[model samples]
Target chain A: MNEQPVIRTQGLTRYFGAKPAVYDLNLEVPRGCVFAFLGRNGSGKTTTIRMLLGLLQPTRGEGSILGHDIRSLPPEARARIGYLTEEHQLYDWMRVKECGGFQSQFYPRWNEKIFRGVIGHFNLKPTARVKDLSRGERAGLCLGLTLAPEPELLVLDDPAMGLDPVAHRSLMESMVYLTRRSDRTIFFSSHQLADVERVADYIAILDRSVLRMCCSLETFRNSVQQVRLRFPGPPPPLPDIPGLLQAFRAEGELRLTCVHYGATTEKALRALAPAQMEMVPLSLEDAFISYLGERGEKSFILSETEAQP
Target chain B: MSFNITISTGLNMPIYKQITDQVWLAFVTGKLAVGDQLPTVRTLAEDLVVNPNTVARAYADLMRDGLIESRAGRGVFITRKRKVFTREEGWRRLEPLIDAAIGEAMTMDFTHQELREAFEKKLGQWKHVKGGN
Candidate 1:
C-alpha cells in the first residue's frame, strides 16, 4: 500500500491583493479516507481548494497533491484528480451523452461503461440537454463526469450546496459508494453537517482564514460538550477552566461549552459548588456552532432545569 | 432482520461505541443468537451512511471483546459467550442513574418518600411486564 498522503501543505498562504484569503494552512489528507472541510461563508475553503488544484497560486508557502507540487501541478497530475465545484459547472448547451463524450476525450483512461453506469444509476436521460435538467440533476451529472474519469483523488467543494435534502443524501450515498474503492480518496467541503456526519471519517474546520480543527469525526465529537451548571444566584465569572471553549451566563445559570471535558474539568467545576451540573453531549452541528461562536451573550438558550442540592 | 443497528449522530456517544452497544444489547436481549451473521462492514456503513472504517473499528472491537468472531471466507458470527448479569449487578449499574433522576425530582418539588414510592411502583410494573424473562 502506498503510504504517502494524498494532499499535504506547509504554511500555505494566499492574499487577494491586500486581503489575506488563506493564512498559514498546513493540512494533511491521508490516502483513501473521506475528509470533510468545514467552514462558514468566506472562510477560505474555496481559496484553499483553488490553491490545492493549482488554479490559484498562494502568496507564500507550498503544497502538493498526489506528489505533484501545487505551485506546479502538471495537467496530467490534475487529470488524476477529479473536481466538483459548488455550482457543478457544466456546459448548458451539450446533451447528456455529448457532455459525457466531451469529458471522456480529456481522460485517457475514462471508462465508457462506468460513465454509462453512473448515468444510469442516477436515471439521467442520455439525450437531455444540460440546460433542461433541474439543478439537482445537473449536480448529479457533474458528479457522474467527475467519477467516470476514475480519478484517484476526488475533491468536492460543497457538493451538497444548492441541493435539496434528497439530492444531498443521494450525493452523499454516491460518495460513500466511491470510498469502497481501495485507491479512491475523497476530500469534500460542505456546510451540510448532517451529510458530513454521515460520510466523513476525518474532518477539518476552518475559521478566519486559518485551519481550526482537523481530526477524525469521532475525535471531534468526543472532545466537545455542552455543560449546564446552576447556581444559587447569578453565576460568577468562570475560572480559567481548561478546554473551556465558551461560557454563557443567564439568570441563576451558567451554560458552558467545553472541549476535552474530563476528570480534571469536572473536579474544577465541583469546587464551585453548583447546585447541579450536567454534561450534555452536543450534536455535530451544535459543537461546530459553539466552536465558532464567541464568548459573549451565547445564542444557546439555557433549557429550563431546576437544580437540587 | 439480523440486528436493527442504528448509529446516533450525536456527540453523546461515538459511532463505534454506538455500534458496539447496539450489537451487545441485541445479543443480551436475545434478538441476536449464537451463529447469527452480521452484515459486512461496507453494507452496514452504506446503510448507516457512515465511514466503513468506523464500522470496521466497531466490528474489530466486538471481536476483541469476544462477542463476535470472523470466519474466513464466510462472515462475522455472534459468539454469545458474554457473562450473565444478575439483577443485583444490573441494578448496581443503574444506581448512579437513579440517583441522578431522584436529584432532578427533588428539584421539581417531589418529596423523597413520594419519589421512592413512584420508583417502586414502576419497578413492580416492570417485573409484571417482563415476566421474569
Candidate 2:
C-alpha cells in the first residue's frame, strides 16, 4: 500500500556500442507489486534488467532502486535484492544444499525456513549435484537460492522458461508466497505472456528496443477494444478518433483497433453509422500485437473503408 | 484468507479473461469473500507489469458480471456467492475446449485411455486439495 516507487528510471537509455538497445526508458515500479517485463526476444528487457541491477551501465539517464541511486549504490544495495537470470548458472560441483549454504553467506536476510520450503516444494533433492540435475531441477535450485535470500526486491528473468508444468507451478507458488509474506517487489521478464498475465500486477511491453506500452494489467485490458464494421460498397473513411491506434480495411469490412476506446470512441463510431457494427473484445496478445505493430511503423493505422461521396 | 491469481501463457486463453475467471473462481470458492478488497488497478497492473488498462478491463468485466463491485471509496470487493454450474452448463462451457485439447493431445500421441487417466488423476488431486471447494 506504500505509494512510493520501489524502482524508478528517468530517461534511461542503453546502447550496445553504436546500436541503441534501450531508448529513453522512463518507468516507475511500485513497492510490493509483481511487475511483469514483457517483450519479444532482444527487446532490451535483459538490458534494462541488467541496468537496474547495476550489472550494466546505462549510456544515459538515471534511476534508483529502493530509493538508492542505482549507479552509486554499493554491492550492499544489490545484496538486499535477489536476482535470477533466465540462464541460472550455479556451481556444477556443489550439492543443492551446499549451494544454498554458500549463497546464504552473502545475504544478511537469508530465510532458512523459506529456503527449505521452496526446496521441498520443488521436490529438489538436497544432496543432488548441480551438474547431475536436470535443466528444470537446476532452474528450481536457482530459484530456491534466490527466494532463500528473502531480499526486499526480487528480479527474475524468465523463471518459467524450460520448466515443466509442475515445476512452473511450484515456481509460481513460491513467488506468490514470497510476495504475500514479505511484500517483496517482483520484476520479471518473460516471453511467456500467460505467466506474465497470471501473477503480474503491472505489465510493460517492449518491442524493437523501445517501450511500446506500460500500464497496470487492468488498464491494459480495458483500454483496448476490437471493433468490426461492414459498410456498403467499399468501407467508409474512418474519422479521426483520438484513441484510435490502428485501422484496416478488408473485404468491404472495416476493422478499427483503439486504445482507451470507451463511450467516446463508441460515439465517434456511431456518428459514421455504418451498415453493421460490432465491438469484439480483444485478447491481451491481440492488443499487444496491434500496439506493437503500430509502434513499429508510424504509417500503420487501423484499416477503414474508403469514404463514400 | 489469501488468494493468488494465475494466468496460463501456454494456453490460448486471453490474459484478461484468465484474470477475470480466476478472480471469479477465487471469490466463488470463498478463498476471497465479500468485503475482501482486491488490489488497486495500478497495484495489480504493476505487479503483473501489464498495461493498467488490461487489469481495468478484467475489473470492469467482473463488475458487469456482478461477482465484484466497486465501492466509491473503499475499492473493488467480492460481492456475491459463487455460481454453481449445473452438469449441462459445465459441459456446455467446457466441451469445445476439452475437445480441442484432446484433439491436440491425440496429435501428440496420447491415447484416449492415457488422457482419461490423466484427467481422473487431476480430478482426484483437486478433490483432496483444501480451500478450493
Candidate 3:
C-alpha cells in the first residue's frame, strides 16, 4: 500500500472573470480508497476536477496528482491515470477495434483482456463504428478504454450521467470489480447518492464554491441524523442546540435535523418536556438531502384550507 | 451452495451489516451447510454491485463470529462451530431485544400474558424448524 496520498491540493481556487467558480479548495485523497465528490449541480465539482487534472489553470494555489504537479504532469504520469468525463468522446469515423488499437499505442501497460471483457460484457461488437453505438455503448467503450490501461488512479466526472438503468448497472459492476484490487484509487463526482453509499469509503462534499465537509462515508452518514419529539399539543419553541441543520414541525411533532446528535444534544432536547422522543435513522439519500437542503424551511407549504386547526 | 441474498440501499443499516445478517440467516435456514464454500469477495461484490471492501468486511465479521472460516488459497467456507452462547452471554445479547419486543407489544395494547404467549409461539416455530433441519 502506498503511504502517501494519491492526490493532494492546497488552497486551490478558480475564478471565471469576476465570479469564483471554485474557492480556496483543499483536498487529500488517500490511495486505494474510492473517494466520492458530492455536490449540487454547478457547485465547482467540474472546475475542481479540471484543475486537478491540469485541464484548466487554477486561479491561485496548486495541487498534485499521483505525486506529479498538476501544472506540468508529464505524458508518462498522465498515462497512468484514467479519466472519464460525462462526454464519452471518441472519433466518430473509427471502429471500436480501431479505437482500442489507437489507444493501446500510448500506454505500455494496456491489458487486452480487460478491454475485451468490458466490451463483451457491454455486448459491443469490435467491427461496429463509433457513430453507430448507442449512448450507453459509447460510455462502455470509454470505460473499457479507461480500464484497459489499468491506471493506478481513475478520475471520473459523473460517469453515470445520461446512462440508462441497464448501462448504469454495468458501470456499477465494472466499478465493484475494480475494488477487488487495493492498489488502485477512484475519485469520482456523482449525483447518485445510492451508488455513492455502496461504493465510496470516503467522501468530500463541495457546497456551492466551498468545501463543506470531508470525512468517511460512515462518519458523514452518522453525523447527520433526525430526531422526532412528539408533544401533547403543539411543540414548544426549539431549544438552541449546536450542530442543528434544520428544524421543522410535522403533524404537531417537532423534527430536528442535526449534524451530530450526541448526548449533549439529547439532553437539550429532553428539556423541551415532550411527551415522547425518538431517533429516526435516515438513509444516505435522505441524509444528504437534509444536509444540503435549505435550513429551517418548512418541508411543505400548506394551503389556507389545509392549514386550518 | 446457492442462496439468494438481497439488500436494499434504502435501509438505514450499513451494507456490510446487511450482508453479514443475510449470510447468517442462510446458515440458520439450512440453505448453507457446514463446509459450503462461499463466493469470493470479488464475485459477490460484482453480483451485488457494491464495493468489494463491504463484502470483505462482512466476511471478516462472519469469520470473527465463528460462522465461517477462510482456507489458505481457497475461498471462504461455512464453519462447523455454530456460536453457542452461555446463559450470561445470551442474556446480555437478548435483553435489549426482549425489552424492545415487550415495549412494542405493550404499546400495541397487548397484555403481559399475550406477550408471553406470542413469545412461546415464536420459540415453538423456531424449534420445529430446527428439528426438521
Candidate 4:
C-alpha cells in the first residue's frame, strides 16, 4: 500500500458567519480504506467534506485532497473523484442508459463493461426512467454510474438515508462489491452506525464540530468498553475518575464507561470493592453515545427510569 | 459449494470477534470437521456484508491460533488438529467471559455455593447442545 495519505488537512477551520462549524481540525485519510465520517446532526461533518471538495471555503488553515490543495483544486482534478449525494438527483426523465451515457462523457477512464456489470448486478433495466424507479434502484443506478467513472476516491453523504432495510442491504452489497478493487478509497459522512460498523475500516467522529475520535474500527471498538460494577450497597459518588467516559448509578448497580480502557482503569474500579466487576463490550452505537457523553454536557448514561426509551 | 454462517455483524461485539468465536465454537463442537474447506475471505465478507479485511482478520487469527490453515491456491480448511487443543483454546477465549458472568452473579448477591451449582446445571444443559451439530 502507498504511504501517502489520499486526503490530508492541517489546521482546517470553517465557520458559518460568527459560529464555528469546524474548529482547527487536522485529519488524514490514507489511501484505500473505507473511512467513515461520523457526527451528530449539525456536527460539521458535511462542512469538512464540502471544504475538502472545494465546494466550501475554510475560514483558516489548509487541506489537500489527492495531493492537490483543496482550496484551489483545478477543474480537471475533480474528475478523479466521484460523489454520491444523499439524494439521488439524476434527471428524473432520463432513462438509465441515458444517465450512464451523460456521466460517461465527463470521465476519460469510463468503462462501459464495469458500468454494465454493476447495473446488471443491481438488475436495473437500460430503459427504465429514473422517475419511475424506486429509491433503491435510483441509488443503484447512481452507483453504477459512479463505478463507470472508476474514480480513485468515492465520497458518499448518507447515501443510505431514507432507504428501507432491503434497500439498505442492497446499497451495502454494492459497496462491498466495489471494495474488491483494493485501490479505491471511500470517504463518506453518515449517522447509521450499524452500517458504518460493517464497511468502514477507519473512522473519524465529530462531536459538536470538534474531532472527538479517529482510529481504525477495530482499535476504536477495542479501546472503549462498558464495565458494570456491583457494590454491596449504593455506590459512592463516582469521584471524577480518570479514563471514565460515562457513569450511571442507581441504588446497588453501577455501570462505568471507559475510553482507552486498560488494566489500570479496571484496577481502579476494582479498588472500590465491587462485589463483581464485569467488562462488557460496546457496540459502535454504544461507544459513540458514550464518547459523546464523555464531553460532560451530553452523556449517554441516564437514570434507570429516564433510560426506558 | 455454498457455505452459510450467521452473525449479527455489528451489535455490541466487534464483527471480527464474533466471526472468530463462532468459527472456533464450530470447530470445537466438530460441526466444522477436519479438512472442511472454509469459505474464502471474499465469499464470507460478501455473505456478511462486512469489510473483507475483517473476515480475513478472523481467518488470519484462527490460522495463527492453529485452528485453521490456508493452502496456497487452495482455500482455508479446518486443521486435523487435536480436539483437545480446540478445547484448550476454548477455555483461553471464554474464561474471561465466564469469570465476569460469575463475578456479576456474585455481586448480585448470589452465594458462591449457589453460583457453583448454577454453573454446573448450565454446563450440564449446554454440554450436549452442540453435540447435535
Q: Could you report the Cα RMSD, in angstroms, for every candidate shown? A: 5.8, 11.6, 6.7, 5.6
lDDT tens digits by residue: candidate 1, A38-125: 8889999999999999999899998999999998988999989999988778889999999999999988889878777777766789
Model 2 chain A lDDT-worst window of ten: A300-309
- List candidate 4 stretches off by more than 4 Å: A294-309, B1-3, B80-95, B104-133
Candidate 1 chain B weakest ten by summed lDDT: B124-133
DockQ, all models: 0.51, 0.10, 0.54, 0.67
CA error at residue A53 for candidate 4, angstroms = 1.4
Off by over 4 Å in 3: A230-236, A248-254, A273-277, A296-309, B80-96, B99-113, B128-133
For candidate 2, the TM-score of chain A alone versus the native chain A is: 0.90
Candidate with the greatest lDDT versus the true structure: 3
Pairs that collide in candidate 4 are: A283-B12, A293-A299
- Give the Cα lDDT of each candidate: 0.82, 0.76, 0.84, 0.81
Candidate 3: residue A123 Cα off by (Å): 1.1
Poorly placed runs, candidate 1 (over 4 Å)? A230-237, A250-253, A296-309, B6-14, B61-66, B84-98, B110-133
lDDT of 3 by residue, A173-285 (tens): 88888877788999999988888978998888788787776777777777778887877688888768866778878765898988766887888999999776776778887
Chain A TM-score per model, please list them: 0.89, 0.90, 0.92, 0.90
Model 4 docking grade: medium
Candidate 2 lDDT at B80 equals 62
Give TM-score, chain B, model 1: 0.63
lDDT of 1 by residue, B1-133 (tens): 6569887664556678889999987876678888999999998999988888889999998997778998998988999565445789877877767767876797699998998899889777555232334
lDDT of 4 at A187: 91
The TM-score that candidate 2 achieves is: 0.70
